[model samples]
Target chain A: MISPIGWFIIWLGILFDILGTIGLVRFPDVYNRLQASTKCVTLGTFGIMVGIFLLKGFSPMGIKALICGAFLLLTSPVAAHALMKGSLHFGTKMWKGSVVDKYGEDKLGGEQIEKEG
Target chain B: MRYVLYFIIGFCLWLLLTLSVNLDHLIVGVVVVLLGTVLFGGYFTDKPIKFLQIHRLFWFIVYIPVFIWYMFQANIDVAYRALHPERPIKPGIVKIKTTLKTNIAKVFLANSITLTPGTMTCEIDGDYLYIHWIWVQSELVDKASEIIASRFEKWLRRIFE
Candidate 1:
């Protein structure tokens, strides 16, 4: 059974998860959704992993949870960056409310090599 | 020496992951790390000794708490905007430059910006990092970079460089 503190942390993680999902659905554009889903989901999952570690203590399960959390932190931003770079290169328009487009301005109206990566 | 360092790091990672001090586990970990070091260690940093520097390790330990603090603040800020009816956001892309010479340092800087609230790194081109800002308070490149990357850069420079 999970301790009270562990349960609290788990609930916090679930709350973040819900907020991130709401952000994902309600955001106007792809980039905004990426920001919400990527950052929030990474933190939410990492929090859940931390909760699991606290519940299990220093045993194998807890150690595994920590490792999973570390990997999540390392990889989520990479995925987000890749998605954003692809979308921008393919000319996905920013929302009308967006204030500026520096990337578009500098690299504007130019064809990019598809297999650049 | 680099290979030895790689082997030791790999062994330590295995110990942490497996969390077992049994004799059999030790034997298997050593064998696996030996193979891994042989196959992949060459790609690791040329100056693996830098990893052993006391200041770097100390700063890294110190950085963890600061990062977590910023992350908490970011979540609160984003959560507020998400729950707000008008979504009081002034989203835009902005270009900022990092003074950190090392690519690894720049990578960490980019990752930190993305992980934090109000900013997401869209691209890194040499010294320049293009960011998607949730709230565009500053339009100037120097000002934006200062706001976005300077906090982490101060610590990362000492640790990585």
Candidate 2:
């Protein structure tokens, strides 16, 4: 059985996950949706995993949860970055509420990135 | 040197995975870790060792709580915007300069920015990082880096640079 504190954390993570889904549905454009979902889900899953680790203590399963959480933390940002880069190169339009676009302004676009990529 | 680090990491991971105390586990883990390290350790850089120095390690330990607090704030920031009736947001892609020199440090800086409130790195080009921000607080590059990267950049510089 999960302690009350662990339960609370798990619930909090669930709430964040739901909110991220809401953001995915509600946000205006691909970039907005991508970032909103990525960050929230990363933190959400991490929180839940840590909560599970708390609930399970020193069990092998518990340690795996911690390892999985660390992997998520390390990988999700790279995924977000790659997606964002792909979206930009694909020329996905930014939302109208956007104030600026430094990416489009000075970037040499696909060629330079691929050479270094 | 990198193999040594890999061996230690793999051995610890094996111990955690088994959660056991046995000579057999130890022998198997050592053999497996050694073989694994020999095969893959060449891929990793020895440069990260500088990051493991005493003062830098101390900064890393101190940095964790700070990072978690910012991450918590970032989540709350997202929730507030997502839940608000108007979805108050001023999205933009802005350019910012990072003073940190190393690729690893810049990567850490970029990841930290993504996890922090309202900013995600779109591209990293040399000293400049283009960021997608939920709120465009300042259009000026200097001011923007000050806002977006300064907090974590300071700590990252201490640890990695």
Candidate 3:
């Protein structure tokens, strides 16, 4: 039987997923949306994996969940980096309220526009 | 010696992936790790002794819990900004400099920054990293670096150096 703590952790993951979805809709622009989806959903998924591990203890499925947790930790940020680069390259535009644009000042920002991938 | 490190890592991965303890599986794991070590061990480190330093391993063990704590903090911080009624975000790309000298250290720093809340590493030029921060609390590079990287940098240096 799954313990109460395991169920609670699963609920927390669901909550985070819901918050991420809300963030995607509520945030001002693509960049903000990306932040919400990447950070929140990744953490939420990690939580679910941990919860599964808790429920299963040292069984094979539990060990698999732990491995998945490690993979999620390593890969999520790389995926976020790629998404940010692609969005910037395509000139998707940031929120007008944004206070700074270091990329706009850099030559690389414009260079990406002409290159074909 | 480097081959030993490679074998251990490879065996661990094999064990994790297969979740098996049969003699045939054990033999297969030994073969895979041996072949893998022959092919890739030297590529990871030229000085096996340096790479396997006890001090570095200790630091890595210490770092894991600290990193997890930071991850939790980051999630809460971002969740607050994402959910707040005002959405008090002052997003900006700020340049922050690193004291780390090695390429691997720099890579680790960049990945850590990207993972943490409020900041994302967009570009790295020499000693400077341009980060996209969700909340632009400070404009100074030193201040930004202190806020974003100070937690992870010292431990990373210990491990990578």
Report lDDT per candidate.
0.87, 0.86, 0.80
Candidates' TM-scores?
A: 0.90, 0.89, 0.85
Model 2 chain A — which ten-residue stretch has the worst lDDT? A108-117
lDDT of 2 by residue, A1-117 (tens): 567778788889999999989988888888888877987898899999999999988788889999999889889999999999998987777877777887887874422212111
DockQ of model 2 vs. true complex = 0.66
lDDT of 3 at B131: 85
User: Which lDDT tens digits does candidate 2 get at residues B50-150?
Assistant: 83679988998899889988988998898888889999988888899999998888999999999889999999999999999998899899999899999
lDDT of 2 at B152: 88
Q: Is candidate 1 or candidate 3 better by DockQ?
A: 1
- Candidate 3: clashing pairs of residues: none
lDDT of 1 by residue, A75-95 (tens): 999999999999998778888
lDDT of 2: 0.86
TM-score of candidate 1 chain A against the true chain A = 0.89
Provide backbone clash counts, one per model. 0, 0, 0
Here, model 3's chain A TM-score works out at: 0.87
Candidate 1: lDDT of A80? 96
The local lDDT score (0 to 100) that residue B142 gets in candidate 3 is 95
What is candidate 1's CA lDDT for residue A8? Answer: 85
